[model samples]
Target: MTANRELDDILRRAADGGRISPEEALLLYTDAPFHALGEAADTVRRRRYPDNIVTYIIDRNINYTNVCVTACKFCAFFRAPKHEEGWSHPTEEILRRCGEAVDLGATQVMLQGGHHPDYGVEYYETLFSAVKAAYPDLVIHSIGPSEVLHMSKVSGVSIEESIRRIKAAGLDSIAGAGAEMLPERPRTAIAPLKESGARWLEVMEIAHNLGVESTATMMMGTGETNAERIEHITMIRDVQDRTGGFRSFIPWTYQPENNHLKGRTQATNLEYLRFVAVARLFFDNVAHLQSSWLTTGKDVGQLSLHMGVDDLGSIMLEENVISSAGARHRSKLTELVSMIRGADRTPAQRDTLYRHLKVHWTPADDPTDERVVSHFSSIALPGGGAGGRTALSVIDAQ
Candidate 1:
């Protein structure tokens, strides 16, 4: 009875927008009823966006180079910088992708890559400049704190200076890549060569203070403890309290296939839903919480809508990183809107900042543009990229 009352108290506190400590969050995650978690989280989501409209983005993840110096064991997409198969796409080639994205009604382009031994700040500055010059309208929401740290080291410049230069050269915002698990022990176990969780937040703080906002992400199921999971979000919430620059919080499970950390530890669907619910309760200050349909299937993604996720990630035109590891979920613009609709929420297309571009209140209102698709594996990455389709080639029959 005492334990049940504890769960009841936590749910009540969470539903009322009260802050749950790491211990309480862990408790709720481990014991609270699933639907209760969902109900409380849904209450929070509705409070955040009373319009009852769910949002999604039209974008493509462009992996500029798969050649990496930081060979994190959990990654399957990165090739050693000297590997024969490694390559880097030319500026013109990347520009062609941006052109395709713009034509397909994509407003954002996610530019992410591994830590190339020689590519420094100038490498990114040039790429950003070229992409922006070609498609000034597309938001270059690219890179992350990890890239910034690596480039700063390669260029022998300050992190602040690197961020300023890149933003000056068309880098609009940072994506929360390389932030696998921000806690120390698990992060070290998974990615020894990557920046520390503190350092990652430090770099993000610099970007935020510099006016370059970004989205925060978590890569779960990396053998981290439930307490550690709460620790991760606790860290993010602390940083957000100071910076207020993270536009959204996105959580996705790790794909442990071809990577070194092979399928040993993966979070279950119940675990994911519990985490999502707790996140909405804990991250009251963060404006948006997005679900990863790319990592979790469309069903789980839709189910997440009732569990506090206000946004479905994107109709990714291209995604090479997770595909190399085994994330095969895929959906087109229409299909994603339909999925959201089936969940009993209206669908809307949003940009990087969570501003709605188009809203579909009725089934007939969904956009009919065939080219607006989750075209992850349609085209082979002729330049330096990963093999296998990014949007799960397994379901390519679509």
Candidate 2:
């Protein structure tokens, strides 16, 4: 068959609810026409959502520490152990942030931070228990595979034991944060000290076995090739087929600002949308495909809704890691709703696990009564800017 016919056949098969092999996915990524891919994927998206409407969630990303033992090359957020500016938030401060998030109508808190030394599984248990105790309604959808690996080591516990302890303490789900590039070579090249891609999946599998669901993510626009991208999604899809524990798939561009990979440009808007659409088509088992407005701008985000993304990510009451890496796109509750509505979709506020909390069909119908504003707080560095203090605040209105 010709290339166009081959692409058409793959799209047809995918649309007819058949799975695409990794080789076919690679061809679609490289050879499929942009509009053709978008149309095929959008068809699948409509079949799943059916409502011509997209959605978004409102949550806070609470980074509890920046002091990291594993130094990933593509990261601008983590600080080295002796960097003088490395730090961890006290448990009280973490609770205070949780209280603030709850007050702002945030139903979910992404408690992400670097792999801090000496912070064993007990530390997370205490923090999660305290947060849940104070705000039982707030969803603690936080941490990732890398942190789990580190905690297992620090506490001398098994990965299963560590995950169980944290879940017992109130971790609702694991955030797929450290999945920078799931293919072996690129992941190792960028994050040498981090857990292997297989190991990361192993942790998620263990969490899934423990009845904890997670969202799978891929850090795109890095140096990985097209085949590697498909490989990443295929790996996740295989796992989902077995465990059915992954709730959504989120692919976002890598911010190449402050870290060692500074010379590389971030993925373009077109590239991001293409991946978003392809993910919808490829990951047939995963239920939700999220459009990341945090990395891609709002216009691209809006476009993605029709292209295959159903969720527009979060309001992000607070986000520091991506911002520190030079992602500047910011959206308020009003603007987010407006974008979704403008695209002829209904915007919904969701919890960490993608459960629909509230749906805003129109601008006049928004349920959030709190004012939105941005906070300005700093993360203390031991020596001071390389290890310098980085202050971050959330956009809130009150």
Candidate 3:
């Protein structure tokens, strides 16, 4: 049979509740027509989430340190230990950001940064504890596998102990940030200094066993083959089958600017949509599939909603890493809701843990007329101004 026929057969079988073999999944990823794949995946999404609405979260990404020991090739955000601009935010700085996030109506704070050498489990314990003490209601959804391994090595503590200490301090959920590429060969090629692919999953498994749930992410278009992509999802699906601890699966394109991999480009919209559809079809054990608006533009993000993505990731109050890598698309609560409604889906505001906080069926008739402001960094705000800078910067400059 032709590749298209085979993919159709496999998708039909999957829709009928039968499992598709990995070989068939490879064909679906490579040969299936875009609309066909999206339609089939949309069937699955509708069956799972009968409501015709997409969701997003109000959150902020607070990078604790730009000083990283593992200089991943695809990362434009990390700086070496002795780099002139390399810096680590003190606990006070982090808390201040958390305060800003809360004030901006952010429900979740994603604390991510490079793996610093001197900072270990104790650093996280102190930081998380302080954040929780200040903002008890904010969800401390932070960290990734790379940091987990580094913490274990630096502190001479076991992975379980590291997770336990962080959880005790205030980490409610873990963000699967360091999972750029999960296949051993491709992962090593892209981020050799980081933990091995297997080790990344191993730490996540340990965290899951210890009652910490995390979202799984895959950074595609990093020179990995279609087979490698399947392998990445298969690995996460297998782990989810065992632990059932992954709350969602998020796959985004690799940004290729200001990094070692500067010559490369991100995956095309078609390729990204195919991956999102395949993720929905293959990972039955994973509940949510999130579309990356930060990496992909709003149009692609809306297309993803039809291709089986239930979540639109986040309205990140402040996201520096991807911005540093040259991702320029920005969204606010008003714009995000309009995009979801334009796609014939309801727009619901969700907390970090996928709990629906507010659902909007109609677009915001009048946009918020609050005074536009700029942060010290070049963050593309909803109203076309920078945001998140300290008042001191403005005063000192004057």
Largest TM-score belongs to which candidate? Answer: 1
lDDT of each: 0.86, 0.80, 0.81
Please report, as a residue range, the 10-residue window in candidate 3 with the lowest summed lDDT: 389-398
Q: Backbone clash tally for model 3?
A: 5
lDDT of 1 at 42: 93
Once model 3 is optimally superposed onto the true structure by TM-score, how far is the C-alpha of residue 83 displaced, in angstroms? 1.3
Residue 158 Cα positional deviation in candidate 3, in Å, after optimal superposition: 0.5
Residue 145 error, candidate 3, Å? 1.1
Query: Against the true structure, candidate 2 has what lDDT?
Result: 0.80
lDDT of 3: 0.81
The number of the candidate with the highest lDDT is 1
- Model 2 lDDT per residue over 1-398, tens place: 23578889998888767888889888877788888888888889888887566767767788888888898888888877767667677777778877766777778888988788878999899999999999998888999988999999999999999999999999998998899898999898888888889989999999999999999999988788888898999989889989999999989888877889894756778878888878888888999998877777789988998778888887776777877777777766777888888888887877776667777766778755435422223232221111122443322111
Residues 335-386, model 1: lDDT tens digits: 8988899999999999898889998978889988755656544323332222
TM-score of each: 0.94, 0.92, 0.92
